[model samples]
Target: MNRSACLIFNPVAGQGDSEQDLAMIRAILEPEIDLDIQLTTEEISAEELAHEAVRRGVDTIIASGGDGTLSAVAAAVVSTDISLGIISRGTANAFATALGIPDTIDAACQVILQGVTRTVDAADCNGHRMVLLVGIGFEAEAVERADREAKNRFGVLAYILAGLQELRNLHSFDVEIETEDKIIKTSAVAVTVANAAPPSSVLAQGPGGIIVDDGLLDLTIVASLTRAGAIAAAFHLFQTASAGNGAERNDIGYLRAKQFKITTEPPQKIVVDGEILGTTPVEIRCIPAGLKIFVPSREEEEAVEKLEGLPNLTIEEKPSPENSPD
Candidate 1:
């Protein structure tokens, strides 16, 4: 029995040769599955194409682009039995990086052919379907600074440079956050609410790691800091995301909830899934097991783990890093 799939390819996603990527995807996937190729145009979006695929009753819908493309296609098929497949080919590729999906076209296509499926959490951010985190304040500012032209010129380094620049002007603002059980007030430079985030998305790694299938959103807030303190805090967060090493830092706040309503004193900017979506007084709600996706088998994951020899870092509090690293 062969699986029927629709491939929604974005030709202008990353700064790569779209022709070669498409050729590789078709060569690898078409042999194992009945593939329908859909080239996305400027007029018709990936989400629209995915809905069309759903109407045709394809067994799988595969998206070949960045996080935006994957999220759009996922939105069209959430809670349905149709398993979504990803062929990551975009700047950052953060969603794929978070899920342990290989970004290479060949490896991604092979994962789809393997036919293993995993169901994960998703979210609704002010009625927009969200498959990733929503960033407010510092992270949002950094995102804005890394404009399309800058990102195209410098790749991932653009984000790093923007983050460094934003650090200089970091300032705290008051926030009122409302959850189901409680209402809290605080002042912070940054706030992140995440359904899923890669390790490199340090701002969203509040509880050590973001569990995409956990049916809860991880919320992190960076408490008020001066220019120098903010730089140290940023380094601290990088440590947390990379090595799980920032637990003793009281300046950073962390929690988990099913929903959150966040309001800022000065009306902070918001970025969802890499797109700037204007100021915040935003609400986010988690949907449990809302997405089904193709992933590598457990055996494959274990094999990769053995090959990589990754360090096992747990969520234990390290010494307060106010002066630890600069």
Candidate 2:
């Protein structure tokens, strides 16, 4: 049976030639699927177009951009029967990298053509849908520093350079984290609430790794005060993330919950799915098995695993056909 798909593409994502990429995608998918391509004009237009695609009863809505574009499209299809596909053309491509989605144009189109789907968890922070992690304090600052110009010039290295700059002026602020079980009051330099993340997101690393389909959010807080302590903590987290293990450091706090309300003394900036979304006193809640996404088949997964160094860090169980969207 032929499936209908709408590709909502962001023209400005990454440093790609959008026309060439689009042509490549169309060439790969058009033979198997009825594909419609739409270019995104503004920030939230992808979400609008995704909703329109859903209304047209398309079988899949593919986001052809970075994490921000993907999140926007996912927001429109969450809890729906429409399967979301990804074509990573963003700087970090963090969510795509985490899910073993290939960044190459041909390989990504191949994943969509293969058509394997998996149901995963998503969350709501304030009113916005969250498919990746949210960063506060240091991470947020780093993101702010890694502006569009820097990203266009330096790619992923922009984030590192920005992060290093942020580290120089890092300062902890009072925070109150409220979950159903407990309330934590602490002074922290960084906090990460992740629904899904790759091993590269060291701040969200935990003992059990980050389980995207587990119906919970992995939260990590770095409470290091001094610059040296913060740097050390960051290194520890990177090591833990690389190993796909829980944090074993004293300064790092790790936990999991279905919902969280975080408030900072001096309101800190919040970055959700790579877009900085203003200051926080934010509330977030998980919606388990809320999103249906295209993933690699078992055979393909194995082949990719052999080539990749780090584990997905967010996947606990093998993705089964039973987990496909309704």
Candidate 3:
């Protein structure tokens, strides 16, 4: 492992004083990494701190907060060569889960010590660079509601509560999705533009959805009214999966593509990771392997094991400098 490093720590995250864990992490990493701790007080602090670390020639930048912090730091390293390390200390460590990085600080630090790095796809949501996935429609609204209370005593349950609340008032919106080869217009409740699979939510559980290295983004769109209706729609979707063809329900539209341009009648709120960004008329594209991230042993091992099972699988790495909209 390289000796030069930068640790961007969010003191406000986790159950209590993250500094206590930060101190312990520093102690563990001190022998192998040069730990420069930067405490984050605001959202913009992550990019500024990351840019500074890159300018100082730090070989690796450790994102020590939750998914939002990780996304911000990742945006700063879009075109840079520095590798990212994850310490999952936020309410929902989605990116951490997605990357197969351990939830424990000590376990993540150990992976850092091992010095394994893998390049993964990133997406440009309008101009903002995203590390995890982007949520649209009801999910975005859920994120906004969750954000209000998730900062306090609320945990992941806050998101669940907000989601159910959003579900109670759910209404499909008229929207158009423009892809390279098709234009689909539909009324949908929620849409997720994902760079990595299973999202951060499912990945925390050891095994999950699509491989991050697949070079394609997964767009999961839900176009339903009631909560039970949405659950039924998912089951219908799996039937199409077995046929190796995607299904577009009268209410639900789910598909995967590389680039998409979306326009809604009334601009819908967009959430990147957990933070809500601005609204629709957004252009999104996958920048293959735009950032190098640490993948935990389980994800890495699973990825290798799955590759052997695929008789028709294609793997490619895109190291080109990612371009974000102005």
Candidate 4:
């Protein structure tokens, strides 16, 4: 019996040679796997292609693009038995960074060939599938400013430039957050609902870090008023994130919940998994253990072992997709 796989390639994701990368992936996995390749011509094509691949009984669905492309493909495979693989070729590649997936073509292909799977949590926001965090206010503005031209020239620095510009004009808006246990009203400059995030995503960094399989969402709110205050708050959150601790600043609020509904006084743009979705008033619910993804076996196992002893956070469990909550 031969294994089957589908590679959904996004040609314009990052500054990489897609042709050469695909060839390398083929050379590495073709011998043992029946690999099928699909090129994405437009936005959301990867998701559609991934669904088709799953319907055709492909054992694994690999996304070869940036975070947006990967998010689209991951959305299709979530709640299904097929495992998701990544070949990072995007600007931030934040999802890949969170999973410790290598950005190199050969290294990424090697991960798929290694054949290790980890079931992770994914979330849904108003019918949109979310694998990483959703950002409102400052984060969304930063993403909006980091356009294609900037990304092509400056890479991740584009985001930094945009962020600095956004900071100068930051303003707080009233938001009401409804969770299973509580409803809170507050003024915030930024809010993040994170399923998984790398350390660089300082806003998503909670006390325990952003746990992908925790069955809960990490929410971080920034309520700073001044530019200096916002920068100070961000630095504090970054320090805590680096230390694997949740933010401990008075202006920065952090919490964990299974579900959340957020409504802003004035509608604000929302960025889900790197793509700007429409305005605010979105409902997000955690789909625990909904996604099975291929990861570096040894590194993931070691990280899991280290996390087992942590309090308030659950270690990864091999949960059945059928058991996923509706």
lDDT of 2 by residue, 193-266 (tens): 99998877777775437888999998999999888988788888888777767777788998999999999989
Clashing pairs in 1: none
State the local distance difference test value for candidate 1: 0.87
**Clash pairs (backbone) in predicted model 4:** 206-246, 207-245, 207-246
Which residue pairs show collisions in model 3? 223-251
Candidate 3, superposed: residue stretches over 4 Å from native = 42-44, 197-208, 231-250, 297-300, 303-326
Q: Write the per-residue lDDT of candidate 1 for residues 30-145, one digit (tens) a residue.
A: 77788889988889999899999888888789999977788889888886788999999988999788888899899999999999999999999988888889999999999999
> Would you estimate the TM-scores of all the predictions?
0.90, 0.90, 0.83, 0.90
Worst 10 residues of 3 by lDDT: 199-208
lDDT of 4: 0.88
Each model's C-alpha lDDT? 0.87, 0.88, 0.75, 0.88
Local error of candidate 4 at residue 174 (angstroms): 0.7
True-structure RMSD, every candidate: 10.6, 7.6, 10.2, 8.7
What TM-score should be assigned to candidate 4?
0.90
Model 2 bad stretches (over 4 Å): 303-326
In the range 164-260, model 3's lDDT, one tens digit per residue, is: 6776777778889998899988777777777764332421111124557767777777777787886566566555554545564676555668888
